[model samples]
Target chain A: MKKLINGVDQIVSEMVEGLVAAHPDKLRAIENTNVIVRADAPVQGKVALISGGGSGHEPAHAGYVGEGLLDAAVSGEVFTSPTPDQVLEAIKAVDSGAGVLLIVKNYSGDVMNFDMAADLAEAEDITVKQVVIRDDVAISNPDDRRGVAGTTLVHMIAGAAAAEGKSLDEVEAIAQGVADNVRSMGVSLAPCTVPASGKPGFTLEENEMEIGTGIHGEQGVERRELMQADAVTEELVQHVLDDMHLNDGSEVALMINGQGATPLMELYIVARKAIQLLKDRGIHVKKTFVGEYMTSLEMTGCSVTILNLDEERKRLLLSGRE
Target chain B: MKKLINGVDQIVSEMVEGLVAAHPDKLRAIENTNVIVRADAPVQGKVALISGGGSGHEPAHAGYVGEGLLDAAVSGEVFTSPTPDQVLEAIKAVDSGAGVLLIVKNYSGDVMNFDMAADLAEAEDITVKQVVIRDDVAISNPDDRRGVAGTTLVHMIAGAAAAEGKSLDEVEAIAQGVADNVRSMGVSLAPCTVPASGKPGFTLEENEMEIGTGIHGEQGVERRELMQADAVTEELVQHVLDDMHLNDGSEVALMINGQGATPLMELYIVARKAIQLLKDRGIHVKKTFVGEYMTSLEMTGCSVTILNLDEERKRLLLSGRE
Candidate 1:
């Protein structure tokens, strides 16, 4: 595999170092851990919002760390979950009087570790509340759904509430509200290579695509022959709309997120079809973002996220804090 | 071969349609033409800036069309220059009484077509000036150098000046000055495939890399065994510093641009090394941008651009218009 890393084992720490160096005015790394926090963390009156998982899905948990986004992000190795101790350090670093909120994606490893971290923080009298995001509509069973790009939306809502100096209970409720409303589905044309493995987790023929794939190169709902851009986008969007019960006249926010290697041109193409699909069904798209907000290494694919927005959610969505 | 385009022949138009639909608040396309203009074009009494080339290098010409960037961008097919008529239409649509400026890359086709368009615009009593950017230090001959990612910096500088109501002559001079001061070099691990061709422009084995490939997937100066990221970056950076004659205490703005498929993690790794290298050489990096600014379709590689900045250029660079 052709990766620009110094050593496979050093990917996580080096990436954290590089991120901190590049955004010194906006972010900083914990002294000896894989934890990234806002440059001005521990704001005396604001609640702290922290989220993280593996290292491969970049800009996901870390890149969103800014004034109106995440206050801190705890990272593990690629495709691995961070230890509870690391998450506990992040909570201690960012917690202020208002309390702290943990935005955990619904991966088995991530949920367990973050829960332990929350418990540890609570033991220290740091009121920590956890909002588990399980918004992947591809999974038929709600209890078995895996969190995906929609987690970034949860971060935005919770971060905005925290930045506005909301209490711990208010922030957790608002975050949970977004988690309940958001749904996402993804399609992958190619699999990503983990640096240590130096091989793709899976492979698709030249004309095949995996519909409803998860971010960490997980299997999708179906492997079918490649379809037109519009058709593929329709399938993804349809799943989300149906799962969210977003019908005619339902107002929502849309995100066309790229899974690393996808081009912005293609993302816009997907966005075009998605907006038209929603418009044809009488769904009003109040806000839209199209880019590589969260990525799966160099995987070539995209995810469509729909967040059923209310006044509070919409206000937080367009807060423009970051 | 695995592109998300509808058809090989329709990639350009479809991509333009998608771009306009996604960014309606900031951009619009001229009807029936491969030309994208600012949603608020024809700002009377302000010089207009226009730039264009192949469609593959997105966000270079179109994504930069906002408050402090290009007023219009003409697009050709993938890896192909737009026709003179398309460029002429862009000039006519964005030209206000203050005149217009065209930022042309050093590619032969782009230069010829844009020059023809300028002549056509002149016949219609529209004042037009051209700035040809040829900052690639990879090409030994100064006259034969091809413009690369550094062209975006010219747009940022010229765009800011024009937005500030600078005269046509003033904007053109500032753009030309930036074009002269900037230098860039790139390395590619694989080649990019043009949709019409259905194949990459060239091929490389698993352990090979091109030292200075052009954005069109053209062969670079050397194709040798793959090296570590820092070593490869050192070669590219050394060429720029030597060619530019930048010495100790020189202040420059650095850009570590990903060529489409490269991950943000890798780009940050490159940025870390590039910044450290410059610091060791006693050059001060004033501002830095690390992301996929200009890309070669889906090629896995990156480019480094350094602009030897003066006070005026620094002011315009930090104007943060876009």
Candidate 2:
């Protein structure tokens, strides 16, 4: 494939440089670490929020580390979790006197690494609170929770609370509240390439799409028959609603995230079906987002995430949101 | 392709449903329209900040609509612009006694359609101000100002300001300032397929990449010989920095956005080089976001956007941001 770069080894650093260069107003590189933080991070009393996973989902963990979202983002290699030290550095970079909150997705590596870093920070008296988002309902990881698309909600809910000067406990509780309210399911069509190898990560036939896939293009729940977008939405939403136990008349927040390769036309088509399916089932949607919040590189297909809204949860999610 | 959908026609609606379902507390959907508004939109007499384009680049128009981002999002069909009537509906829905500021990307159709809708809204005496984001450094339409990647910055700067209860004139000034300070350039590798056609929108040789492309897999300025990721970063950044005439000590925000398909590893690699290039050039990066913010569905390459920032722009971009 055609890429714009000097060499593979230097691509990530170069891109980070570009990121730092482009937004000198709000971002800075953590010294000697593969992390980016807001220039005004560690706002004294504000709980510091730090979240990161792989490198490809940009404007994500890092782009989000601004005034109201995240304070710091620890980036791992592509599709990989940051090394513990990287997470530790991020924790150090943004740790305020108040405390720090580590918002991790349900992926094993991300969990273990960030958890270890949190432990280290706590040893340093940082008082880290951790919230793991295992909200994807599409693929049932036996006895394990795999992080998927809904992780963004955890970041926003937690980050917003923290930005508003909530304590670590409050931020953690709000994040947990968001986790309790959210469910996600994903579908993957085309396979993506690893940056170093420039080769497809998985193999698929012309008429195949893997259901319940993660951002890394790993096997999802099943390889069912390829169907139209609407059928796929039905299947995905069925799992999400059932998993979340959402019923008719329940209000929710919806997220239809593209898995990288799917175009807006197709994704919007999927989004429409997702909304119609909820309406048909009498679910009252309070809010909706369709686009690439979380993504797998170049993977075709999309995922749907729904957050059931309760008064408290809604208040927190919407509190200080404006 | 394998997709979790029941039909094509209903995808967008369903996806919106799923999104709303996931964040009921944080967001709200307008009845019977593709438009989405913040749960806390139109706070008293604050200006309603509205912006949108196609449906694929999630979080761009809608995700940014929460508290300090956007007041309403008007979605068009896929890469197409939202209809004027739809824009009108959103304008009316979120008009909170104060005027509304429409942050539109620099696409021709988007500008024309949003302009038409603004005129219609003007008839309603809702104070309306608009800033066209023709920020893409990539030359689209040759003779016309190409609105490419940098439009997202406009949304961000303006959204942050508007969220802080900025007046219509204040929001407009911020939007205009951001629109002036940002410039973007994009490159695509392999084109991802459109969902309906189940075929790639544009094709590149397996080893080639498309440079200076639009977010919708539209043609770009250059399709040079394929190079390593490092080389790619150098060439793209050189073009971007040169285009912006960024002085050696200028501070800016760098966005390394993945087109749909490239893996995270590649984006990170590219990000690394981007960072180094800027530092070497003596450009102080204030903020950096690397990910798929504005994507060209499933296309294999990435784009680089630079938003030059100053103190005032920085303050607005950071203050009261959620």
Most lDDT-accurate candidate: 1
TM-score of the second chain for every model: 0.99, 0.94
User: For all the predictions, what are the DockQ values?
Assistant: 0.68, 0.32
Cα lDDT, all candidates: 0.89, 0.75
Query: Can you write out model 2's per-residue Cα lDDT over A159-203, one digit (the tens) per residue?
Result: 777777777888888888887778888887777766788888887
Check candidate 1 and list the clashing pairs.
none
Clash counts for all predictions: 0, 124
Fnat per candidate, as a fraction, reads 0.52, 0.52
Give a tens-digit lDDT track for model 1, residues A211-312: 999998899999999998989999999888878777688889899999999888788888888989998999988888888888999999999999999899
**Global lDDT for candidate 1?**
0.89
The weakest ten consecutive residues by lDDT in model 1 chain A span A313-322
Name the best candidate (by DockQ).
1
Measured with C-alpha atoms, the lDDT of residue A112 in candidate 2 is: 95
